[model samples]
Target chain A: MGCERYRKYVGAFADGELEVKENLEFLEHVKMCPACAARVDEVATMKGVLQRVYAKVEPSESLRQRVAESLGDASADYRHRPRSGWSVQLRRLVVPVAMAAALIFAVVIWPSVDRFRPRPGSVTVVTGRIVSDVRAQHTACLGRSGGTHQAADLPLDVVGISNVLSRELKLRVLAPDLRSLGFRLVGADRCGVRGHSGAHVLYQALKKDAYLSIFTVGRLPEVVTTSNAQIFDVFVSDGGPLAVLGWHSDKASYLVCGDLPKSELLGLADQIRFADADTQDPTEPVFVRRDGD
Target chain B: MGTETGQGNEDARTRFERVAMPHFDVVLRMARVLGTGEAEAEDLVQETFTRAFSAFDRFELRTYGARPWLLRILHNVFYTMRTRAKRRPTLLDDVDFDHFADELDEHASEPVSADSVDWDQFDGEIKTVVAALQPEYRTVLLLWALEGLSYKEIAEICGCALGTVMSRLYRARQLVGRALRNYASQRKLNVERFN
Candidate 1:
């Protein structure tokens, strides 16, 4: 009975799903209790066996080719718009309702027009460095939260219990309430990228293997404005998961980077708007109305 | 050609390849187990991907990525295939899993006095033990063990409640644990005979 409570967590502990604090707590109990420790070992060992034995059950090259060929031969996709639009009268009739529907979707998804359109024109070294810094910061945050690395090094209050952004960055940065998009604000961190006093609010997808970081750099990192300065670049060598969207208003530069699909990241970028520093509330991160909202 | 509609078409293919294509092998392996035969399974996976590609624009990226969406589509395809063949009725969903869940979990909860037997010794027979499991149990177990998906992700793939995934996982692990324990015991007996 004494060990039964601990035994239920034996699986999660072995799976490494328990948060660092919870893992440390369980580790303390397991050291004194051989029963829980043994259970962990048993479950971990069996899981290893199952994975090792069944991992060989994989698809062959031919199946891959067949699937690829099928995709190639598949009929027109959902975007296969008809060559003809409605008559001009029908277009005028439907335009208002279409705009209303667009407004409804505008709360989250973007029609990709001013979204993450990549403009590599006038690319400067500073712009590239900002992207790299944002990616590194996202990877570092994921590492700390991933339960494998730096668990012991993290402060106990690192996971959303406190907000150091207001005190540390002293910038008008809105973390942008992302809960509607299935991500919970994990925590915030102060970062130094190329001598820029920057900060990022980390958002982990609720029960998913993805993380998003909304980074706001002081002084906008020298990325001159060009067609909204919303250049979205993804280095394929990074295995394509490190897609990042960087944009700048008149002052501060912001980069939204994540391991999520690029469309979602762009949708998040649409929500990131900034207010004039003097007019904005200094004590609180400001969320200005998006253009045409 | 430079119209918004044309651009949307280009983006659809690019996004689908980036998001959905990476999960091809994972879905294929799952299809093999879900379908009765390898050729049929390959056909099913191809059809699933074809459908996914056709509807890629509508597939939204939520808490999880394209993997869950692709898996959900694959399962739907498999179910339709089974329904056509009339082989889907033996799914074991009608069985009183609650009674068996408690019974098996009770036995498994009291693990066999600490797994002293060598796991490598039973590696050959382990696949058999897992294969003997019911489809629902095997599917959940393999998703967790091989794919390394979280319970929530698995629940999304299985289209079941989170608690349902937990109970199914518990039952799956319980059954596999019992088999491993029996193998350990038999291995112990064989060692005793040699000694």
Candidate 2:
């Protein structure tokens, strides 16, 4: 079950269904396993092909109207049968009362907006802090690189760096394959923001003075919503030459910052399979390789 | 007195059109894919809407919006119609999706190399293989890949276990992925021979 063990995840990863942390383990496994690596590449490519080929058929306007017509007046039961008596009197006052409420909320409360802000330790606040940290680090790290070769922690061995980051940050990470977008994984190191440990993996583009970095923390706060939220919903912020994007999957949250246009950063983000992984892979490793030149 | 009733009906129609009509395309799209060929797709959509309209009073606006609610109704309607049309009791619940997946797994062919096959040319083969899938496998695949619904949402819509949704989806993709690779490889061979 060597390949089989990772097969299910390969499918989910292709679909971008794995949690952020779960994605790390799959990424790590794929690096070492040649067969699984090819399998993932194949599956991901096939998904794109299938999506393009699958019939995106829609009902004709005539068919839709006919269906609506068939529903008949019986759907009248859907609405509250036009309430009368006291409800009519109540309806008349609703507009003025709503206006009064809106006016009061704006004048009395909008100024003290800090009170309504996500309390510290909340998912939004923590996520915001993580994004800021990644942004600051993206700036600071590039200044430190200062015409140096990709060395130290992010040595020639990428699999080792992924493992080291996963081991140090206590969450698994692969330096991610961004070469297709003309960026190479330069190196990785562990960093933290306010006690939140993170894997800070850096990428340098073919274009001079261009850099991209990914900061992932396993300390993802549970986002409680009224219902299921989409996993691929990327949270974007801070535009200009540099932009930061945040997204979550499983138990990890990712903050990606790049010194490029928002459009370019977004294009790069599309290349990453955002998901979570605990990075505690208790398996034999294989196929040592390098990511960037 | 009659005017009030007319006004009420108009209000209801407007509300139905607002809340439900917007989702007609998705429901119809899924129904067409789930139905045999395209002829009865409209019939399926009609019955689904009919059922949904009758039960519309029960539908409260939920957090995920009207799409999932509308889709759940469509899912139930599609399976129910298939059972009735076949004059058989192949209830959606009766089939063990896990066992069904196990069967597909046993027969799935080895995957062709990702680099060797240019999938862009095999659009017809992709359509053919997907259409050839069993209805259950097709439903899971379409809902996941085409519809972009989450596993939990799919489970809710299909009225099956979450594990079963995962099982069916995995098996469905495995079959699709294998078939596409095979088709692409076969196409490459044909092109080579002609050349």
Candidate 3:
């Protein structure tokens, strides 16, 4: 068949959406045609890169708190039964009485207004400390290596290490696959931030001489900011030689500190997956579905 | 009756927290892509959850997951806000592949070697190109490429036919590819001029 007829199928073929017979034919044609092969390659690369760019964002803790408060109000309102005329009139007076009490309480507490208000943009102080600690640990690891060192003699493979950490920390530990991104696992170790026990997993890029250290903290403070088209609330600390990106889920918090750009670090962060906290056994290996599976 | 109502509300809240709230980041991500900016996206997400909660009684987990359902609410909220503000989104439909095919061939034949191109520069360029795409095209592209939604799920979230989702994604890729090739060519021209 002419290239024109096969052009439309190229996208579906790259997406792995073509029928079995058509997919076979499409692959056969691409092997013989460089232009068609290039088209497929371009599509595949774009898909992979874009997926990396779309890192999962951790919504700010404030939002979650707000939602919970709103839901509480909603449930309270639902609990109120319909009332007769006298009760309705009493309910109307209750609003004004409540407002009066609130006014009095506010006046009494007005002296401590300065203490109550958080400084502008300083809401993420706790998150900042966690990220800083992770960055410091990563720097320490680099200094310990002294440019190059043999991989640490760890007793566990990636899964075994995850199980051990998950059990010890009492939080699910996710070991993301980085082989496709050209990084191989080095080793794992026990680490902590602010007395919270956790695990630190190290990886080195296969091609580039770059290193990545992922620190999983059991108790992490919520800190996040929104930027540009990216949706994830990834707290990026990029002042030093290494860039640190931190985020958290309901179960555990994570920090990926490395000598990489913010975008690349965020991409690596997205690849980390945790097993369901209630269903999966901490001692069992967590399964991560690969791309194009 | 009062106890029953309270139990129902509690159940609804529990289901929402478990099913809907977990997908907040996904909804927020889609909102940022679909809305004007971060603040606007955050507002849209807030409104989406508010509306979704009010209508939570109708939500069923059997047919579709919470992500798609939440996304549908987000899209509705975004468009409704746009409509109320009298801001009609400009839909770009010029899907001419022939023009891009020649460019692709020329660009692919004499491909810029990996060593020659600065990866950071390329990454920034790709982001810029994607951000510059028309909203209609960008939404479908993001839903498919970034969110990893299948065509069927995209159709459900987008409230369109599966074929429409496929075509929009194809066109979006073509546009992005064309923009990328143009960027590379511009860089090449600049390098030659300097040399």
Candidate 4:
């Protein structure tokens, strides 16, 4: 066959779409043909580069929330219920109004309060600490002897495990269903973040040595809200070697941190179900407050 | 029974969330490619989900995952909107591929090294080149090359035959490759002239 016919198979071969017989034929042709080999390599490399570049375009969190809301009754299990039409209208107006108010504040209230001006990137103070603490716990625990446990040692079921931990820790612990995402709860430990008591749950990938740590703190001063505000006030940051995805509700704050990509960590965060601490007895005592008022 | 109905709804929602929602990023990426701008892409994605949710009952979870199905809906939504606005559908024959192929062959000997390429600039240039292609070619190429869909899957998403997918992809790659070669050669020439 001429080079043109073999050229037609180049893409299919690179994509591994060709039949076994045709794939072997294409490989044989390329061995003798440097130009065809170069072309194949170029196409394959371009495919890789394109995937890397284009896959970086993440959809905004607002868009995710908008789609979830549009699902209406279909997505009833979604944590954030859709707002009523009037509330939606109010929200639409609130953003622009708030922007206008901020503009006015900057213009009128600025000159005298230069000292109080918020520092750039300082908004993620609480989130940064949470990420750092999670990374620290992950390292410390992974380093300590007899720190990790097997699945057989603890409750294997996510909900069962969370229930046990919640009872033991006297806090509403969330055990996200990560089985579908190919992760299993390996163990749990008593860990504290910034001197505040919390639970650090460890998970191991079913087929890999990848580990993820989920740290829950009962109370932290809400420092800031990051990009995704629709579901929960959440922030995502890179913790040196690991990526951290953390979110907060009025009752508790949770962070899922791992060496995985930010997107993967975020996916795990989305699956987490924060226990409704509201339903628990009020006198049972929630997160440990800081010493002395 | 009430309990049975609740279970069914739960199952459907779970399936949709797992199968359909996971592809949100890629769908949005394709939406940006298909739509005119960010706002249009957002609208396209919204409409795609709305339609997909409505049609979720027909989505057979056991047969296939949701990426291709969602992509088909996105493509249909984009083209339908374009048609309603009286815009011309970009046809494959709109571009002269013979010349593109010739240009590509001329630069075949001067293979560009992967490391030598400025990926950021190359990414932007490729995006422009892709956006300029006919919609038919663009869809096939994006599905096959970028999204890593199989030719058969691309055929299914595109509502075409496998052979058609192969032919369009070949031509699309040639066009993109030629454009990249031209851009690289021009950059090299400018650098030489300046120095």
- In terms of DockQ, the best-performing candidate is 2
The reply for model 4, stretches above 4 Å from the true place, is: A73-293, B1-11, B60-62, B94-106, B114-118, B189-195
lDDT of 2 by residue, A1-293 (tens): 45555666655554455765666677677667765555545443454455556645666888877876787645544344567789777867886899899999999987799576522212111111233454465545333323122233444333445434443443433444455345566656555543555556666555543455776554233321311442333333334354455555443456666554455445434335321221111111111122322
Cα lDDT of model 3 by residue, A76-191, tens digit: 76567455899768878897899899898788876688576523212111111233354455546433323222233333455455444443433334444455345577666565
Interface C-alpha root-mean-square deviation of candidate 4: 11.7
Which parts of model 2 have CA positions greater than 4 angstroms off?
A: A16-24, A76-245, A250-293, B1-12, B87-121, B188-195
- Residue pairs with backbone atoms closer than 3 Å in model 1 (clashes): none
Q: What is the C-alpha RMSD of each candidate to the true structure, in Å?
A: 15.3, 12.8, 17.8, 21.2
Write the residue-wise lDDT of candidate 2 on B6-121 in tens digits. Answer: 67667756666777776777787788777776777888888887887777657633544566778888878877877777744333443353344334453233444444444555
Better of 1 and 2 by TM-score: 2
Best by lDDT: 4
TM-score of each: 0.51, 0.55, 0.53, 0.53
Instruction: Considering the two chains of model 3, state its CAPRI-style docking category.
Output: incorrect
Residue B54, candidate 4: alpha-carbon lDDT:
69
Compared with the true structure, what per-residue lDDT tens digits does model 1 show for residues A159-245? 111122222332223234455345566555555444544556665555443455666553232454242456533322245545556
lDDT (tens digit, per residue) of candidate 4 on A191-272: 5544445556666555544555776553233322331352333233334435445575433467665555455455445434
Chain B TM (all candidates): 0.75, 0.77, 0.82, 0.81
Which candidate, 2 or 3, would have the higher DockQ against the true structure? Answer: 2
TM-score of chain A of 1: 0.34
lDDT (C-alpha) at residue A98 in model 3: 97
* Alpha carbon deviation, residue B30, candidate 4 (Å): 1.0
